[model samples]
Target: MSALLRDVTSAVGDVPALLAIARKAGTDAPQPGQGRTARLWELLASVAAVDVAAARILEPHFDALAILSQAGKGPGHMDGAWGVFAAEGPGSRLQAKAGDAGILLSGSKPWCSLAPQLNRAVITAYAEGGGRAAFAVDLHHPGVTCEEPAWVARGLREIPSGTVHFSDVPAEPVGGENWYFNRPGFAWGGMGVAACWLGGAVGVARDYRESLAAGAEAGREPDQIALAALGETDRILTAALQHLARVAARIDGEAGASASDAVETGRSAWSEALRVRGTAAAAVERVLSLVSLNRGPAPLAFDEPYAKRMADLALYVRQHHGMRDDAQLGKLTLEEECPW
Candidate 1:
């Protein structure tokens, strides 16, 4: 397997291990402790510590295919080195025009993760007529080429998130124009990203907590300052986790009740996604800062995994819109009902 494929494979493999540990330990995790509910959070945090971006990419492919299946689109799943490059950008353009076979995607799709290694990609492209659409395209097609030296970044360089150029590449439509976003799963998918963010924070925090606990034992005295930092982070993480559980419950309860009801309830799920994403981002930033302060520069500078985890979390959080998303969340707040 290619290095990219191995990286993704290793990152995803950690999910089940963490959940198993969490469940067997009887964590009673502050969030819903029952069944898959608590296990979900455990999985995200565990995998993210290993590889943040890989964890971020895991849930989306299946979520994308599941959405399509519900839309009467396809029953196929994207296996191997795959990515969902549905985000539109002007830098590298992707245009889809309908033709004899099905559709043709030409131009470049930028920021496609695992580009060179990707066997397939599910992308969002501008249709020839109007509106945005989603499609499944083969990366190895004669018309497609993954740009060399994919990207430059302070972190996450291993994933190869570069541009994929397509020239008259045959495409298979997954959902109608705008159908990808219109589906309730789109927002639900957005919320899933937050889970990964929170998971990465947990991984970072775990190191700091272990470091502090060890120090406390060796010194035969607790360092109040470091302990305080850990305490604060725990509070923030607990609250962020609880909020995620509520949002997950909302998606599960509504979509499970009736698929048709999903359309009407999607907006609420999206609104919650915005809310939880912002919450998780802020919590992560706060926790990471405190953890670094408590542990100082040694772990970050010397320990490869520790440093990478810190850098990875820092970069991944910046990928999402911060205040802009929060502004949208403010508007959404008017639409939701609260116990207050």
Candidate 2:
């Protein structure tokens, strides 16, 4: 395990400590498609293996840094934890307007995780002209208000995603109109989330393995069902890891390709991200079912870590968007000359 992963593991239950680790890691952690893309994902997975909540906290912080880097900007004098808040939904929308003072943001943004704890964020809002644009804002600004989280989820209980209301908050534009979604890094960041899902499944599989070993040590011979589940989980996780590595290689391979290929490269990345996320999400679901059915309710009823892992993995993977994402992937595949 990497030192960062080790630190994350040791600080699993402490949110403040995990945030501190994330702050420090932003300085050195590798960004996606930066040649060390594979290592970047491996680190994310390792962190998830120890604690999904820790990965939950760290991924966005790292993603925010990657976003800044992609825009030819760095954290510079800014310090402390950072987050990316780009999710859009119904309700009051965040809007950015240019003023005599500067660009100012007002309205509410949903799904702002760690907003209360983060010092800064890269947020998306409707630009003065029309399309959405990305901006960097200081969370400590007087006009910023992080609403009290109403999160009651069992998994990732440590991280409560909440809404933030901005009242004429001063902001600095990060990129041009619609640049947030236009960049290939958008797809790369989605794959990073899938890596975390893969790691959570690995953690659950480890629990199952340890259980089998304990049974064997107590002079109980392994049953066919137990062995079969283990074998199946091994197959599932192995395939997911291989798929992730292949995607990482593709990302690195296209890093500095010709500008003429930029459009095609972005399309390829979007399709690849959809496929890998689907694969990892499916693998996690299958492993969860296999482990639960074979191991029965004993672990869920008794083991705290095992139970938490199950719940956390269950909730975390739901971010993949399931059938909706599959439909988009199917359309993308159909557009290809030879999808097979």
The lDDT values for all models are 0.68, 0.89
Off by over 4 Å in 2: 254-264, 337-339
Report the lDDT tens digits of candidate 2 across residue range 253-294: 654545443323556778888998999999999999999999
- Over 56-86, each residue of candidate 1 has an lDDT whose tens digit, in order, gives 5554443444454555753335334345787
Model 1 lDDT-worst window of ten: 26-35
TM-score of each: 0.82, 0.95
Which residue runs does candidate 1 get wrong by more than 4 Å?
1-42, 73-80, 254-264, 334-340
